[model samples]
Target: MNKDIRNLSDRIEAVFPKMVQLRREFHQAPELSFHEEKTPARVAEILQALGLKVRTKVGGRGVVAVLEGGKPGRTVALRADMDALPIQDEKVCDYRSKVPGVMHACGHDGHTAALLGVAEILAGMREDIAGRFVLLFQHAEELVPGGAQEMIADNALDGVDAIYGVHLWTPFPYGVVGLRAGTLMAAADSFRIEVIGKGGHGGLPHKTTDAIVIASHLIVNLQSIISRQVDPLQSGVISVGHINGGQAFNVIAERCTIEGTVRSFDQEVRQFIKQQMERVIEQTCQMYGAQFELKYGWGYPPVVNDSSETTRMAAMARRIVGDDNVWEIPPLMTGEDFSYYLQKVPGCFAMVGAGNEEKGFIYPHHHPHFDFDERVMKTAAELLIRSGLGYLSADSPEVTVGNLYR
Candidate 1:
C-alpha cells in the first residue's frame, strides 16, 4: 500500500474500537424492517456529532448525511442498511440482540458501523479530500419496496456521481474480498398461490375438491417450470418456502396458500419463470377443478457492477489487503437493494469476508446464529473510504461530479 493509504488504513484501525462498540450497541437493540425508529435517530446523532449536515427521516426512517470536503471535486455516495430481520437472536453473547424477535442476523449492523467509522474519520480530514461524501443509512432493505427507492425518490442521489456499498459476508473466509463484474446478485421475485376448493368429510368418497391436494400438485408443477423449461445453462430457483391450509385431518381443506421466491440473473429467464408459473397455476387448478389466486411481486433488480468500477475497486482492494486477499467470484443467487442505487449510478457492491471458523462465527446470513468477526469492519471502512477517495481524486479519469458539488 502507498504511504497515504497506509496512513488511512491506520486511521481506520484507530476507530475499530468505536466501530465495535457501536456495532454491539446496534446489535443489542436492533429495529426491524420498515419500522426503524431509534436506529436512524442514533445514526443522525452520530453524523451530527461529526459536524456534518445530516438529513433524518429520509424517505421515512432512512437517514442521509452529506459531508462537503474543503476542496472542490465530484460527489460520491456510500450506503449502509440499518434494518434487522425478524428472527430471534439465539446467540449466547453479551451483544446478543435485546429486541425480542428482532435481530441483526444479516451483518447490517457491521455495515452501518463501518460506514459511520468512515464518516467520522473522513470528517476529520475533509481538506485533503476533494469531493463531498454522502453517507446513506438506509432502512427496510430486508423488506421489498425497499428504502433505496424512497431515498432516491427523496433525491438522496441528486448530485451523486457514483455510489458504492458493502456487505460483510460470512460465506467467504476472513481477509478475502469478493468482487464480481456483472450480476453480483440475483433479481428476486416472490409469489403467493391461493387454491380454492370444496370442503367435505374425509370419509365421503370423492365428495370434495381438496385445496391442499391442489396446492401440493401446483408446487410439484412449479418445480418443473424451472427444471424442465428453463435452459440447463441458465440459473433459476423456485422453492415453496411456506404452505398453509387444512384445520382437521378428517375434513378436506377449502383453501390453501403457497408462498415462495424466484431468483434469476437474466431478465428473460425471470420473465419466463413468471409466465410459466402463471401457466402452471392455471392448468393445475383447472385439472384439480379448483379456483386460484396468484400474486407475484417483482423485487430488486440484479446487482450488475460496472466492469471498470469493479476493476478499479479490485485494484484498490489488492493494495489495501494484498493480492491473495482480493478475489473475483461468481454471481450469487442472493439479492440486495443496493441494486437500486446501482441503477441510478455506476457502482459496485463488494463483500468483505467476516467468516472465521476458528472464531466460531461461521453461520450464514439470516440464520439465528449468524455472526461475524467484528474486525472485518476495519477492512470494510478502509475499502469504502479509500475507494471513494480514489474515485474523487483530481487525476482520476472518471471525474463524474467534479462540477456538481451540490
Candidate 2:
C-alpha cells in the first residue's frame, strides 16, 4: 500500500466507534422502502457536518452529498443503499429492530454506515483528494424500480466519471473480497397472476370452476419452464413468494392471486421466462374455464461490471486485504439496483466479506437471522475510499468522455 493510503487507513480506525454507533442506530430503528423518513435526515446531517453539499429527499427519501477536492481530476461516486426488509428482526441483541416488522436483514444498515465513514474520511482529506466525490445514500433498493433509477433520472450521475458500491456478503469468510468482471448479479423481474373463476357452494363442487385448483396446476406447470424449457447450463429461477385466494376451507374461491420473482443473467432467458410464465398461466386457466390477468414488472438489469473498473477494484482490494484475500467469485442470480448506475457509467460493484463463524454472523442476506461482523465495516470503508482515490489518479482508455464528468 502507498504511504498516503496507509495513513488514511489508520485514521479511519478513529471513526470505527462512530460507524458502529451509526450502524446500530440504523438497525434499531429500521425503515421500510420509501418510508425512510428519519434515515435520510440523519444522513444529510452527517454529510453537512462533514462540510459537504448535501441534498435530501432525492429519489424518494434518498440523499446525495458532494465533496469537492482541492485537486482537479476525474470525479468518482460512492453509493450505499439505505432500506430494510419487511422481515421481523429475530436477533436478541440490543441493536435489534424496534420496528416490529422492519429489519435491516440485508446488511444495508452497514452499507450506509460504511459510506458515511467514507464521506468523513474523504471530507477530512479534501485538500489532498484528487477529484470530486459524490456520496449517494439511496432508499427503496429492496423494491421494484429501485431508487438508483430515480436518482439517475434526477441527474445523480450527471458529472460523475465512475461509481462504486459494495454488498456485505455472509457466504464468504471474513476479510475476503469478491469481484467479477461481467454479469456480477442477475436482472430481477416480478409477475402477478390473478386467476378468475366461478365460486359455488362447497357441497356442489361441480358448479364451481375452482380457481384454487387452476392456480395449483399453474404453479406446477411453471416449474417445467425452468427445468425443461430453459437450458440446464443457463441460470434462471421462478419462485412463488405469495399466494392469495380463498378464506374459508370449504368455499371454492372465485379468484386466486400468485406473486413471484424471476431472476436471470441473460436478457433472452429473462424474456423467455416471462413469455413461458404468461403462456402457462393463460393456457392453464383456459383449460380450467377460468380467465387470468398477468402483471409483469420489469426490475433492475444485470449488474455488469466494467472490465477496467473490475481490474482496478481487484488491485485496490488486494492492497487493503492480502492478494489471497481478494478473490474472483462466480456470478450470482441475486439482483442489485447498482446495475442501473453501471449502465450509465464505468463502475464496479463488489461484495465485501462480513461472515465470521466464530462471531455467529454467518447468516445469508435477507434472512431473519442475518447479521455480519461489524469490523468488516472498516475494511469496506477503506476499500471504497482507496478505490475512489485510485480511480481518480488513473485514466483508462475504455472510459469514454461521453459518459464521464458530464
Candidate with best lDDT:
1
lDDT of each: 0.90, 0.89
Model 2, span 195-277: residue lDDT tens: 99999887788999898899999999999999999999998999999999987988999999999989999999999999888
Candidate 1 lDDT over 132-233, as tens digits, reads 999999999999989999999999999999988889999998898889887899999999999999989988739999999999999999999887999999
Highest TM-score among the candidates is held by which one? 1
Superposition-based RMSD of candidate 1 using all C-alpha atoms, in angstroms: 4.0
> Global lDDT for candidate 1?
0.90
C-alpha TM-scores of all predictions: 0.96, 0.95
Which residues of candidate 2, in runs, are more than 4 Å off? 395-406
Clashing pairs in 1: 74-401
